[model samples]
Target: MITEARQPPGGGIGIAVRDLKVAYGGTRVLHGVSLDFAPGSFTALLGSSGCGKTTLLRALSGFVPVESGSILLGGEDIARLPPEKRGMAMVFQSYALWPHMSVHQNIGYGLKLRGASRAEIDAKVTSVLSILGLAGYESRKVTALSGGQRQRVALGRALAVDPPVLLLDEPLSNLDAKIRLAMRHELKSLHRRLGLTAIHVTHDQEEAMTMADEIVILDAGRVLQKGSPEEVYRAPNSPFVAAFLGADNVIAGEARLDGEALAIRLPNGGETRMPAARRVEGDCIIHFRANAVHFGAGSTRAGLRLAGRITQSSYPGGVYRYEVETPAGRFLVDDERRANPGEAIELLIPTEEMHVFPAGMPSA
Candidate 1:
């Protein structure tokens, strides 16, 4: 028996972090990271492991001490506040539920901690379980629930308190693929329905791209790029960002400006020209996705063409993936037409799909 959908405070409150820094003993994990979380917006902090994404989230939640800078929420600085006072609730990756506790007690634990009356706790727990589609399982112990159900209980616990902000630390990482996908949609729908400000930290690129309104790329404890998912994926600012976002095919070549395009000379005596919008001269590296490459020289589009031989081939489901040994380098290309190894072939890569950055740039 659910009454009405619960709304977060003020329909979600914005958060601002300014030059935040955090360290573990003598080692620094976050280096002056600054970000803004728009009210009712979902942002995903994306990075590789040990990139400090979790550290940043914990700092904002007051679980980690900030060495410098401030965390502002609703125009008030809450950097010094404890976790409970920050007006946020966190759902951990481990589904931090008590195995011995029933779903009802687990969901109402936060309310009880805040000194809420028994009747009030019961009402809130009932509403949460119903909203989470667990109405009849309140008396079931967490040990008897499936992973997905346990996760729902964890989310229920967080939502029961009605915090203005919701923080997720890879909460979907442990579930099976099917359940994880379903949970992604569920979380997104829930966030929209409740208009809650959410900050999710995950290393999965596809998960971030599909769920987040904004994606923040982090590396070595620093913010590398922040933009809409399409913006960052389509126009990465650096080679590291490009490679990290799935544009893994890389080529090294020399470039020189030629009118409106830059003529590139590959190591294997091949040549290509791409539009020049920036002052790029000398050694450079090019990046594109495996799917961006087209087989054969039949394409009439203007692009880079290279003659190569297929060194390896594999069937990774619907398409055949080939490793092409070009004069520039060994490149991965995905195509429907099957080809045997040692067979000569040509590759056509559209100019628009090429991401060129100066050589010696960071690849991580």
Candidate 2:
């Protein structure tokens, strides 16, 4: 069984979802999911499409009704609160901007609806435009702006309300790759500058890993893992998390607890000890990134090494991706130098960097 993390920080208007569950009438979606978002911290809800990440986000905003659970906002159960009453704002993938409203009007619309005076709305909108770097263009219609500018306007609108929490649903998806990367840094900076607690939902692994202080990886409506970006990436608890986090190379087989050491039996009738302190059992898989596995022209490690014949090679951009057939199995090897097809080579994975997971174990 997977154990919960213990290093939770306290005191924040940030959300804590305990035993949270949601479903569509008869079919269950989220399963007893729990997560914490600290005030002024950025958290990403990451998973493949249709994985209930959006549902979970909506639940946090009180848009989706929770069947059971407590959405503790500053330790108060606000699960039953209406979406508008929660004092949180969200930005959608489409920007969700009103085409008919000018940038300024759209930004100040929220405050206006809340009965702010005309002068107050104008003042808030002016400050927001300046803060979001959209100054001198507040009068422009939404349709006249470029994608990045429109994104900024959307952000300005969200921030104009000064909500304690900000929910971003794939806010960078529509931008080009370069623009997206730039915006990611901007968002991080904005978070730090404003000290706003933000929950971002994204399917892009790099985006989530880059922007979030912590990540909650979800799959099939359940959280597979949650940890600091490095913790989840370096020490994933399952094969699924490893694979999901881009641990593509695999040497899966059987293993047993031989006293304190795990004796992993190789496919070619060889066995290796993974030292003591291994927890998982039964069939297990060890995954290393393709970049982690390399083609060594000369073998340095003597025993317990893989000797494979490189059968395919492709120059994908600056790096070489190679397919190696070994005595144990086939593995993808990524190298900087080109290896001629059908060349025999040795691939080494530093034991310390190898991520291992027990078979048949479900992700969180």
Candidate 3:
């Protein structure tokens, strides 16, 4: 479990969701989920389909009615408030821009609907256009803009309202790969400049890792883990989160306390000791990233060296991925050097790179 971080200077009040539960008719989508969004901090809600990430975001935005629990904004319960009444703005995945409206009109739509003076609406739109690098695009129809520009427009519209909290529901999923990567930095910069609380929902693990200050992993309507990206990646509490975060290499064995160290006994009569201090005993499973497995030419301390034969190989841009058969099991490895099938190879993995959990233990 991860604790809430400190608020940045000039940031808004923090948000707390206590035992939040939501449902759609007969079926519950969120089950007693709780979290705290630190003021001016960015949090990513990550999970697979039907994992209740979107449902949780919707509940936070007041778009979905809560079956139970309390949503406290600045220590005041806002669970019963309407979406518009809450001090929050949402940017949808579809860009949600009106094709017929010009960039300025679309950005200022909320202000107009709220009966702001024309001068005030125009002033806010102009400022947001410049902030989003759309100074000269105000008169252009949103349909004529590129995907990235449309994304900026949607973000600008959300910012024009000047809400305390920003809710993003897969806002970059529709953009091209290059644009999506670029927008990640842009969003981070915007969040810093505005000092607003942000909750982003994304199924893409890399996206969540790249943009979030904290990550919350959910599965089957329950939160499996919550922590900083590196913390969650390096010390995942369960097998599901380990695999979900790209640590796909799993090896099972029995572990026992060996004085100050944890030693694992493999089924094939091989043994290795981990540098961990925990005195865990019994059946255990080790999880590690594919790239964490180093082959030959690397110096890693307290590492396991395995002899294997390459069964398959493929060049995947920056790295060459290989499928190797070893005494432990078959697993994928990413290396900079190329090795052909049927070739003998050696691999090493540092003990600190492996995450160990008790087998058959359900996620917390």
Candidate 4:
């Protein structure tokens, strides 16, 4: 465990993890994952299932032991501290409320364990319920409430302790689509109003992008990228991040290094000039989102373009999705104007909004 430096005359409480590693038996799950959270900032740790996000959160909460590393809380090393001593609260995905208890009792359970007076607990519970918009249903059993209500009750319980940091483990996964979106807005507003430092774990990219100030993208137990939602979305550093963050149409091509640009040789022997990729290689893949390309404008004159025929079409809502067969490979494109199948279309590729990376990158 690392012994952090003492305050040199001033003080503040923030959380930092250094060279964190965790393993299950023989196989390692996390490898040297490190992150820093400001005292009043909200960040989200996002990755697919089994990517070790939950494992890392559990380790921070003191529910799991770290194989090798240190967790620094309040400017002191706390890998050895017990859960209660860490002064943190967690809201799980399953709404883990006691079914037999009333909403009031559920919200007051943490204070009771901390040994607060009867009147103190009552006041705190009433205040919290009012804050959570659950005042009228305090006497009602937890089982009688809706899913969103239960979720709010769970949140109220976590907030009653007034921990400096909040850790949420996929707290919106179980709700319906509309409720989930509403909860996202509520959580965002509540976090801003309360000024709570929070780290939320989620696999949903949209949830992370919409709710978090900074997004930490993880894969296979390692943090792949950490930045604002716009940064990660517009300028992805790796192929894995680009693909995992959303549906990206990736193409395999041959890249040759130019002065500050790259000449890409398409599979059909066509060539296009693009910005210099990270690695100069014989083969690589470039990904663009479906909405990034414009349809039916002939070969893109300024940037790269491939000849493709619209093979299939599907309407999800406002826009139509088209599967186009291109020379490099197939690609999914979104067209606002609908068209029948077997129509010829040109995918206009913009030079600025394209991503190029090494091939054979692993998937989530």
Q: Could you say which candidate leads in lDDT?
A: 1
> Between the candidate structures 3 and 4, which one is better when assessed by TM-score?
3
List lDDT for all candidates, in order. Answer: 0.89, 0.81, 0.86, 0.82
Q: Which pairs, if any, clash in model 4?
A: none
Identify the superior model by lDDT, candidate 1 or candidate 2. Answer: 1
TM-score per model over all chains: 0.94, 0.90, 0.91, 0.91
Regions of model 1 farther than 4 Å from truth: 1-10, 258-260
Q: Which stretches of candidate 3 lie over 4 Å from their true place?
A: 1-10, 277-279, 296-300, 315-320, 336-339, 362-364
Q: Write the per-residue lDDT of candidate 2 for residues 69-183, one digit (tens) a residue.
A: 8898878888999998888889988999999999988998999989999999888787777767777787899999999999988888888888888999999999999989989
- Candidate 2's displacement at residue 241, Å, is 0.7
After best superposition, candidate 1 residue 278: deviation in angstroms? 4.2
For residues 1-364, could you state the per-residue lDDT of candidate 4 as single tens digits? 1112121211124789998998888788989999988877789999989999999899899888788889999788888788888877899899899998999899889999999998998888877777677776779999999988899899989988777788999999999899899889888877776677889999999999999999998888898999999999988888788878763777778888888888887787656787775656778787777677757474434666667888999999988988888776777788788778898877766766678776776643
lDDT for 163 in candidate 1 is 78
Candidates ranked, most accurate by TM-score first: 1, 3, 4, 2
Among the numbered candidates, top TM-score falls to 1
TM-score, prediction 2: 0.90
* Clash count (model 2, backbone only): 1
Models sorted by lDDT, best on top: 1, 3, 4, 2
Model 1 C-alpha lDDT per residue in residues 1-364, reported as the tens digit of each score: 1234664444789999999989999899998999999999999999999999999999989999889999999899999998878889999999899988999999999899999999999998988888787888889999999999999999999999887899999999999999999899888888888888999999999999999999999999999999999999988889999999989889888889999988877776767787884657899998898788868666787777899999999998999999999877788888889899999999877888888888998997
RMSDs, each prediction? 2.3, 6.1, 4.7, 6.1
What does candidate 4 score in Cα RMSD to the true structure? 6.1
